[model samples]
Target: MTPTAPDRLVLVGGTIHDPATGRDGVIDDIWIEGGSIVARPTDPSSFRQIDCRGLVVMPGGVDLHSHVVGPKVGFGRRVAPHLARSPGKPAAVPTIHATGAAYAALGYTTVFDAAIATSAAALAHLELADLPILDKGIYLLAADDVAVLNALDRGDACETERLVSDAVRAGRGWAVKVANPGGAVFWRKGRGDHHDLDAAIPGHDLTPRRLLERLADAVQAIRLPHPLHVHTANLGLPGNWRTLLETMRSLDGRRAHLAHVQFHSYSGGDLDEGSFGSGVAPLVEFFNAHDSLTLDVGQILFGETVAMTGDSAAAEHLAHTTGVPWVSHDLHLSGGCGVLPIAYKEKSLIHAWQWAIGLEWFLCATDPWRVALTTDHPNGAHFTAYPHLMALLGDAAFRRAAFDRIHPAVRKRSPLKDLDREYSLQELCIVTRAAPARIAGLPQKGHLGPTADADLTLYRPDRDLARMFSVPAKVFKRGVLVAEDGHVRATPTGGTLAAS
Candidate 1:
């Protein structure tokens, strides 16, 4: 359905929070015309007006990482059947309608499914098409294709370049994501536990090192808006830090983004053989130096969350450990994915440590600009935890309250408890709106400014975290009222932007 603009637009008496435009939130009126935001009209006539009194308005939310559709999502729905049917759960993890409605209700205006196999792009698009109230797109899975990997292995970079471009065009994807690079294909051919970057992937001549380097260079060469979205090797294993470092070193001069770093951060002592938190210090230093690098914390919220990823082995490991009903599938013609239900318990030592590590990343990282807020969407935890995370960053007391609830191990050396650094509105704006928009390569989002899409959120200013996020006073999508006082006033079909 085509979107038709309504005549006359004025958002009156609202505390507008558009960080992209550097509006540190002044009470003002926003005007929109032809689906684009405009400066206030000198003449009051020739416009439809929206009463935004006592509401906070900003650009729509943009999700940088999520598995919203395709074979993997189907597998998730099947594997975690109870997750979809569980009462009181948010829509992001359930049926298509629930995902769309849930996100919109929370004021998310734009989101991207971080990984989708090119062979199954059409199905992914169809799923995104059914999602409501947010512009969405998928990053194509490019690393597993034999022809492309083979070409790169031979140092024929241009041929590899062409295949990547062709895949993007064919898949109509926003960017390319190389997940575990050649490991997926190798795993299918019966190579077990290729956890390091230097390990030989069963069928491919290219090591994960060569695969990452070539893909990073090709993504740089193509000059897409977003870099190669990489899910590194050694995910969910002990002593995988060395692998993560090598993966980063492989793309030293090039541009790239790492997905779910917390899952990749583990210590050698407890869980597995000598495989603990090896890579973070260098990884952090490298990221601080490289302006091109961006990452989402993938902070594990530790609840009845679902762990889903395009990496089949990692997901299978999780499923095996938990003994839950797990689902997995290979794109056959392309890559593969797996999903399992996860719970983060206060009494569980490992889960407590996982939670601690995420906060440590938040406190330890030098610049907030390089990082964005993400629960890795049901992987580490649920997306609904964002408000609590926001509160953790905002109110010191709230952070303490949450910290006290966790296991004692988390309270010991974890920085979350003793730290009293409260995030000012400016910092909150940076993490949620400003930084995310820049990372996702969408200039129009994450801010309120002239010519921007008039997607906004109005909140009843309060110290309550969940209340602030879940029940905004008013929510707008493209200058139209979509939610009012926690009730959906209208349903809008949001567009998913793809680069074909």
Candidate 2:
């Protein structure tokens, strides 16, 4: 018989944490070949091998939504001159190349730049192509684009379908995202404030609710992997949980995801959130009953991070109130984007209250599988805070320690300090890895299972959960080691998963 190669790359003697298959801390080997997993090979000599003994091996992370590389991001960079001088904030957020490198170093092997307007798609792709070590994708921010909005108002489902496909194909996008829906047009119309879904957009005769439903139907009609990713109307307002709930109710049979949901769920409908934590119960209940819906926590970590969004009005509101450096761009009235620098303070009443609400949503939600974890990157907080957030969830003592340092009034009123539920490693896998990829409609990206994609990470075991996740011992993208010992290695190849 002729000698044949094993046709596999074996990662041997590693403890694999594959939440998809319920495999935890089992010192087993994983075999990868041709960018997919395979059965373990017995003949070690025939296979290229990596020694991963005593390491916590898991699938690479998948970020469902982020604005790391897109039009709004460029707008932000252009607007904030002083922000350009900040230590972390760079000229153009340290370039697309740096964006990919930083994310990969943090063990995120796949990231979706949440909102790229169809008109600005080419510009987004230009940067995404240069992104290395992470499979990149984009969501088309089509809120009040005239042609589609016109078609929707006329009840032209056929034309709407055609336009949706045309836009996605032209944009080379992964999914659809609607930012403040009809309000984008209203902002351009000089209204600058459309608080309710029923409020009219300037040129179109449609309400935000109508726009939301139609775009969601359009996305579902073509059988897109992900649903309409929404930033929702009236974000960051007190009593906005009503809007959030109403938004959820409006998505009847369709799969609609709410991005940065923590920002949208507020207890009191106010400029200062006097009745904080009041809106959580109903919102949490609605989420528990709804399975078609998906959400990312967008948990606020107390620190200064650049806030950028496709919703110009919302950003402008934030900028004006905070009096921070702001940036706004008008994209032919279809929608605009705004950027501002923000900080969540431990001593400030509103910031402390906001902090409590975030943790409330995390604990109140029934299932980890339904909610993914994110800082909404450079918005609520930087992506670097993910490790610390994980630490809070994993260690009760850490959560209490952090909670004790907050403003006294907030500490007295907050439910988070009273509620104690330490999340297991398996639960961490669900929220951070498995849930995000599945919610983003990438079935293969998050799991380490038979025939799964060969992107994986290995961490050294430590009681300090934050440090453990912050620096993985070895990180892989498409079966290739890309980062190790807190540094990026040889530039490795990755994919940009998109729907044609």
Candidate 3:
């Protein structure tokens, strides 16, 4: 049994990479008291000091976008039971207990389920309660509600704001997420024509563009900490880059967060595999210029993993093309979700292109602070692949070697070949922890400074970025030692972070 954490402790002589406080590779002593980082005590003898000399320290990771729990996640497990267990490997769709334990073991202290229907928020919350160690929250698909859509259609800003605010409060959600906007409405009607953002929803006068604008207005008016979280139209479709670009343009300087942008950054036309390639260059240019927008890569690692999304239409398209086992459920008025098992092969042209495109987005972006590293969790790849993705971003030589092994067509056509920009440890910290926490509106998380939550990870540095990040020397959750050397030492019930 693990002993309870001491109330006063100090992690001494650690090389810290706290980007939020501008401490880059600075050796410092971190003082903790009552589950919070505090200034050094006047009486040094009173605090227990643990020597952390030679170890690298950073804030506990914050996953701003992931689908760790919810009814759809339950469905995903049911559909692919084989994904639940793999000898010496983390499950793609882990059980609630494993999900929490794995994330905590990896030094992630906080996570947000990026796409939970507001109607299923209570159920998601109940599941999250069982997910020990990580402080968790959910982004509600509130825009799918008929009443909200109706208000948006009628251009009733007051009603839209009231309805969105009410749903957020009722569901205890962290932010408002619109998955494919009116795509589900079309899906329910057995129609696949709503590819254009300006196309009308069959039952409503509102287009996807208008819905986005109204939701942004509502989210802003409600004074929510996080902006409207958007998964734009035509996700995973070739030539969807246009839709993604238009989605950003429609925001019109309003604060918003784009989800799984890698899926949307494609240049090819419908079913044109030959024309399919990276569209990230232009997207990155726009993203760099727009301070109102921030994004998570949804980087696709070459692997076998489940693809799940609240965007049922996109899932259906993938299912039909790949001939994989697929499951989709309509959540009545609150939209729908789709889940499927998929294998991204290194030899497959499209898969290789996707891999290159995600990396291109990571490499091309001018600001690491506006970007968050994610795999869209079991969509592009499993969350467990984050360490590997980190290695790809931080080590350009490793990236080139990996790139050379992929499909030759991608080698010749993709722009990822030319980009050699490597992310430093500080940039990695910003993308993984600081940026995500700030984007998620959790200022207290993703930093190791005075008055901040005393959640952090200490790693014995290694030349191999993947090996260094795969296991930490020690992991702390609110000052309590929870994991050490990739083993879970304690299972503590962490608090739920909700937008008040």
Question: Cα RMSD to native, each candidate?
Answer: 2.5, 3.6, 1.4
Tell me the tens digit of each residue's lDDT in model 3 across 1-500: 34486488999999999999999999999999999999988988888889999999999999999999888898888888887687877788999999998998888999999998888999999999999989999999998888998999999999999999999999999999999988888888898798889889888899999999999989999999899999999999888888898999999699999999999999898654668888887788899999999999899998788889999988988999999889887745366699999989999999999999999999988998889999999888888789999999999999999999999999999998899899999999999999999998998998998999999999999989999999999999999999999999998888998899
lDDT of 1 by residue, 1-500 (tens): 33345455887887867666667768888888766788878887887767877666666677788767787777666666666666666633677777766677777777888877777888888888888777888888877677787887887899999998888888888898988877677667777868678776675567888888888888888877788888898687776656676777778877788888877777674444533332355567777787777888788775686777888877767778878877766646577677777788876767776776777667667787778878888787666567777777777787677778887765775555655777766667677777887877887777778877777777777767657876777777887777777666676788778774
Which has the better TM-score: candidate 1, or candidate 2? 2
2 or 3: which has the higher lDDT?
3
Worst 10 residues of 1 by lDDT: 270-279
lDDT of every predicted structure (CA atoms)? 0.75, 0.80, 0.91
Worst 10 residues of 3 by lDDT: 327-336
Off by over 4 Å in 1: 1-4, 269-282
Ranking by lDDT: 3, 2, 1
- The sequence of per-residue lDDT tens digits that candidate 2 reaches over residues 1-500 is 11122246889999988888889778898888877887765665777889999898889988887777766777666665555567654343446777777778888899998877778788888888888878989998765567888888777889999998888888888998898877677776679558777876777677788888888998999988888998888878767888888888888667998898888877764543566554677888888888888888788888766788888778778878888778776645355568777778999877887777788888888788888988887787767678899998889999999999888988887778778988888788888899998888887888988788888889999999999999998887777677887788746656777886
For lDDT, the strongest prediction is 3
